[model samples]
Target: MVADQFGLRAIPTVYFLQQGQPIDGFQGPQSEKFIREILTHILQTAEELKIAQATELMATGKTAEALPLLKEAHQLEPKNSDISLTYAEALITLNQLDESQKILNTIAIQDQDSRYQGLLAQIELQKKAADTPEIKQLQETFAQQPENAELAVQLALKLHEVNRNEEALEILLTFLKKDLSAGDGSVKKTMMDILSALGSSDPLTNRYRHQIYSILY
Candidate 1:
């Protein structure tokens, strides 16, 4: 009736129907740019809503539930690195290292950002004590990426595992002198562990020997 009254031959219409009632409609297909602008606005609104819900869940100590929502939002927008990284972090907080490592590994491969690379290094180090070829392979894989404080520490720890304290000392000392806050405190803690493992009697150990002595004594 409206189209006939407007003397339109053909009218394109968009309808938002709710329970068979037309709640909203657009008269015609908009231009590509206008449609894209509308879609972008809708997507941003959805992302914000999901982020707010996830944050609420996390605050309420329902991280388990929050994780899946965050994962969905991330899947909806894989280009959002923060969402991906936050999902990995939430998984870590939930003590799901395997899942977290999987996400982190993807980011490390795609982004190769220092933060993601450092995380992969830390995860590998956690598995360093395993007496298997896999641990060695993991270390070698990480060595190919850009070096960070944590990577340096993990490489040092791997070197020490092969009974090369001098090289490990170099890595640990180098990490200690840098701004490693982006990589968490794992680098510093690993340095301590390496110093303890190296023992005070080793010549390369002299640099941190006093600090080690204070800690153990």
Candidate 2:
């Protein structure tokens, strides 16, 4: 069962089991340094266990419960990006955008991975959603000139400013269908921005992205 579960195909396959579950494994000979690093990671200390527990809580939609655990873990490992990112996510979910941004900004630009960028985009989107006057003005202008392509693009930006992302994308899509080469690629850029802010997994983003691909090709 162990061999089958671990998919051991070679003669000297090694499986690192933690609590009867395969956490890490190697199929062949590895250097001492590589083996050491793997072992160090696999063997979690008390603080690591706490962070793991917090991560599970967050995954299960228990951010309130996870926040304290993550805070403790962060205190223990202040520079750990994993903990910081999770904590920032929790804060974002709780509507503590300022605090989340502060934590995110502490992460060095060189260390800003995709997750960091995603969180930052989320924060910016949230901030944009709060700009009521600009959004209202754009909405009024767009309503007055619904057929104007430039107004449509500006209105889409206004919609995105207020978290009406689907509406924003639809506006852009309508304009692009009529003029795929609009705004010297500014239309495509706006669409891409909305898609990026929505993240790659969003169904609407996927749909519109497919449309964009068809238009481009």
Candidate 3:
């Protein structure tokens, strides 16, 4: 069967097959380092073959096998966003939402401001609407990371949703004062948004408004 893959028209003259197998085959999983150091060259050559095979598998609805092959290709070349995206899709199709989300999250965090990460964050936010375990876990983690402006902003938004305006305002202001300087004005805009959300056109809003005006003017 393997010989047929090489387009061998007839029996080989003085055939010397390894264990009656024409193709060199691996029996079991190998270490990541071994695959990276030695098999990378071989994997690069095999990628086109793997993609062809995986496409056939997917066409035949054998997505389970196709997913692993795609994932393997991704491991071989992590920069291949298409492979990573396809693997994430396959995982979703297989009802592996957690794994898919985790992969997307890693991709997003590693490549800040990527469209992939933005999509992942949107998906996470949608899922978080029901107050899932993931959302709760993220909130807990964000609370521990006092220096993370993004997380603070996210948590502040969540707090505002529950009408915890005071807490949200405090968190947002602290984030602005500590991380985002007055010169940047992003934190001031955030403060205005939070104040508007809370229906507070008070002295604080005027102060932030003045700050925003100063930054722009």
Candidate 4:
């Protein structure tokens, strides 16, 4: 039954998987050299493997899906500038200007290569646009009326306009944490909208969805 489920037909059919998906397969006997190459590709260091996966995600415009893997790779090996740069690049894609800048800042003077500079430049340019007058004004007013749910929603809307998604989501989540049913469920609704905008594949969507489920269930 299992062999049929996996579509195995030949006696020596074999499949190799990475991250739970089949990446390579051979239906008949293979040369030792070819088999060794497959083993080597699958046996790479965890950090590099993550970076490779993250690179593919970023290349395909799946920034949200790529971010957690890159972050994990960074945590596993902080000294590897390649991982840090990949993580930073994802942050830039998500318009996480502050976090991306912080990561770029960690690179040593010698390791401040072209990729680091490019990410840094992107953050600087985006940060300037992000520090707009409307956001500034809304942030100031929201800071003063920290408990006002209406004001919180207003500011979150502004943050969402410029693609500061994580920041906007964080602001909404904070209020939701305080009062899950605040504003007659409008607060939760706003969070749902943010998650929807973040896409179903996003790690943030899954993480935040679980958080909301935990509170309700």
Q: Which candidate wins on lDDT? A: 4
Question: Looking at candidate 2, what is the lDDT of residue 141?
Answer: 81
How does candidate 1 score on lDDT?
0.63
Residues 1-217, candidate 1, lDDT per residue (tens digit)? 8566444544576555568765544566678887676556444466567877998989888887787688788778766777777777776565445567767756635676776766666556644543357446656766786356656666767666755454566556555555444258676677668777655533345756654445445
Per-candidate TM-scores read 0.37, 0.45, 0.33, 0.61
- Candidate 1 residues lying further than 4 Å off, grouped into runs, are 1-32, 35-39, 42-48, 108-110, 121-217
Of the two candidates 2 and 3, the one with more favorable lDDT, higher being better, is: 2
lDDT per residue, candidate 2, 61-152, as tens digits? Answer: 88777777777877787788877888889878865566677678778667799999999999888767665887778878878887777777
Scored by Cα lDDT, where does model 4 land?
A: 0.82
What digit string (tens of lDDT, one per residue) describes model 3 on residues 1-217? 8545655555332222456654332334556775565455444455566766777888888877787677677677666565666666665555445556656755534554455665566556544554645447757987688777767667667765644444556666665555456325555566678778534323234555555455456
Cα lDDT tens digits for candidate 4, 74-118: 999998887888888888888767678778888878899887888
Off by over 4 Å in 4: 1-78, 98-114, 210-214
Best by TM-score: 4
Report residue 152 deviation for candidate 4 (angstroms).
Answer: 1.1
Question: Cα RMSD (Å) per model?
Answer: 17.4, 15.6, 16.7, 9.8
What are the per-model numbers of colliding residue pairs?
0, 0, 0, 0
Shift in Å, residue 51, candidate 4? 4.1
Instruction: Write down the TM-score for model 3.
Output: 0.33
Report the poorest 10 consecutive residues by lDDT, candidate 2: 197-206
Residue 87 lDDT, candidate 1, scale 0-100: 76
Superposed on all Cα atoms, model 2 deviates from the true structure by an RMSD in Å of: 15.6
